[model samples]
Target: MHGPEPGPGEGMGRAVLRGGSVLAAGTLVERLARFARNVVLARIIAPDQFGLMAIVLAAIALFEALTEVGVSQAVIQNRRGHTPEFLNVAWWINVVRGVAIFAIAAPLSPLIADFYGEPALGPVLAVAFSTMVFTGLMSPKVYALQRQFRFGASVAITQGSGLLGTALTLVLGVLWQNVWALVLGTVFEAFVRFVLSFLLCPIRPTFRIDRESWRDLFAFTKGMFGLAFMTFVVAQADVFVLGRLVSAETLGLYAMAVTLAMFPLTLFSKVVQPLVVPILAAFQDTPDALRATYLRLERLIWLFGLPMAATMAVAAAPLLTLVYGPPYAAAAAPFAVIGVYTVVYMASMVSFSVYLAMARPELQRSFTLLRALLLVVSIYPLSLTYGPVGASSAMLGALVLAMVLQVANLRRIIGLRARAYLGTLGGGLVAAALVGALTAALGLLNLPVLTLAGLSVVPLLAVWGLLLFRERHEVRALRRRGGGAAASDR
Candidate 1:
């Protein structure tokens, strides 16, 4: 008799590499779209508008995170057959949650306007809030696509729709000349994603809910809710503190710095995290398999993660001046601090996924809560004193501490040594430091932007190339094993 069919995680190591390739390609295109939009947006909109929107978005993000309920993760991690009744329950629950968010946000818009002294915020937030409903309507079939590693179609639907939406925003922003363009663009993007997800994925929702079906899933969802809530706080705490304590102008500067710092992390993490969860979850029962997978992922993350952070930190001045203009040059300082923090943040993200995959969701929530508390308590006083700079520095300190704690916790749980963890990260730090020092030395001579940009890449590329060469054997071995070769490597 034939055994069970191959599950999503059975060959997840290879599948992750494939998924990462698709994600990377999509990320490159998305990065281009974002770069073009920001270049135009920086010129058209004032920093205050970004700051105002940032505050409103933070609150909205909290709501969205809570609404996740980890249903998708629960479905993915469930090794048993996909039951129609369970999916139906999740669908209805999401719809109800979306409606609740819209209702709450609608009445609360006035409060947000009052807090920010921006009367326009009330309507802007109302329009933006509609996205939650559309996002909720997306079929769980999308996750099925992810589970099967059918990412090419998913990437096209997601990135292509986003590109179109961004293009619309650009045209509208130029015509309308304010935040309405951004609000509309966002709403349009969500609507497009919802429609496309259903169209591209084949699963249909049935209107059947079985209480027995949900019994096995509810605990996982509860754990994820706590994890999501705490993650939201940690992610947005700095922005919230800055908006409340600092001037709008200062908050705007901080917002810009944050956007710059987060772009790389967002791009890379999007590629890694999705793949990590499924891959690690596949090997959950085998400690050796999980540990090996984690190490490989850690190395892969640092290879790109470190250089991106380094390049941003080293080239912050030129990059900001080129993209945003000289008036926003103050963003450079905070960008450097936050860029380094992002490197540590990315590592912590890996640990977070590992814990989730191992079904130790409480550990994930505990770490998130600890990080959030540290971030809030530290940034508040710093924002009060030194303004955005102090707040950025405080956040950097907290991120480093959080990463250390996360690694320590992972070590305790997995019984791994710290030396191996540090080994993965140490080379990247040394390379980044060298590049930064070289960039500083070169800056003393007052080079032109073109010259500076060209010159700056030399040290970075050299360091990066050397590191790749140093790991050449392992890279080859990984490729020989199930992992598909990266485009660049191929």
Candidate 2:
């Protein structure tokens, strides 16, 4: 527990709550748009189309991961004085890396197609390479804004562009009735992000590069670069493995499960991650301060994440039917597995952010590497034995191991009590389980889809409400303390 003392008006707890709310709102909008787009695509194209796209995207992700220079994170964490030269040098390096990735991936597309046994993949992959080039040109000023806690504007530009991209893709998919709509949508999103980043963020870079600036940023960027690469591998390993090992239709079903399981967790992480690093950076020097912030964050994460995971687990069948139709009913089991993992995945992510903020980025990188390794070891054997279902189980195992390691590492670093940590998780799990059981019983009785989905929401919301009610005193205390601090600062 070490970091700077929480200032009167700037407690990390309050900042996280406020920031989470803003981020959550933006994420909700983006997820909704994505959901709409996916619903349309699921209906228009065959499952094989998604599977094909998944395979091509996996290769693109790997190349993007390697070429990631991590200059954005470098900019965020550089508490040392920054200058125009630093931004300029980083920008040019990233531009170069982006170009290199496009060059390699474009030529390698044919090879990837050969490996996947799909000749059509070559053109699709070539088109996908453009996303990296556009994303590379995005201003690091966006990262700077995040550091300054100007999240509203950042959310507007990034999430708004994503919504527009999804809308455009859906429209195109309806018109063309093919995978090109989806591919074009992704490219459009990247382009919009690049344009909006520059428009909203004022830090423009000159073409000049400074040698000293490169050296100064290298230590931070190199470690983060490794972390980013590991992140991409862990995220995409399931898709990569399943696409190669299973049929396209099976891979498509698994992909949908992954999406359903990941969307909520991804949304939660996206909202919190940008805010956590800067808040943590500000208090990095004091272990006690960092410990308090970390505990508060973990609790906040469990509060929301556990409920969402529970709701998804309970409503998986009906929700899947409603959104993806009964043809995708096979995805329900895998969706449940991935939903369980989402809890651990979300918690570990927050812990990783705390570590990064504390300048222990190597630890974050180590954990990511471990997760990726576990994924490699688990996915192949499981896919061979149990096929897509086993692959989903492996993903859950990897996430759980990662979460346990993160919590253990945090405790080692700051001496957190095991009972306190488990209590929150156990309570949420129990509550969610009860709700899930109730929902399952209802499903067993042969209720209508709408009835099942509607009834499921009641118990889920009730469980969440009761949990919050029990914690009302703690929430109130935090608010009172935060309010008093703000008045004193004034």
Identify the leading candidate in terms of TM-score.
1
Q: How big is the positional error of residue 285 in model 2, measured in Å on the Cα after superposition?
A: 1.4
Top candidate on lDDT is 2
Give a tens-digit lDDT track for model 1, residues 1-490: 1122233322434655676789789967976797789778878888777787687678789788866678777765664314566666666777788889998887888888788677878888878899899877876655645644557766877787788889988998888877788778888988988888777764557666677757757877777777787778777877777777766776776787788778867876666666667666655666666676677768666765677677777788787777777767787878878887787787777787787777667777766777778877787888788777777788778767777778787777776668887778766667667877887777777899757766776777788778778887775454333232122111
Tens-place lDDT digits, model 2, residues 48-139: 88888788678878998886756877776774313567777777777788888898889988988888788888898899899889877877
lDDT of each: 0.72, 0.74
Name the regions of candidate 1 deviating beyond 4 angstroms: 1-14, 81-83, 469-473, 476-490
My TM-score estimates for the predictions, one after another, are 0.91, 0.90
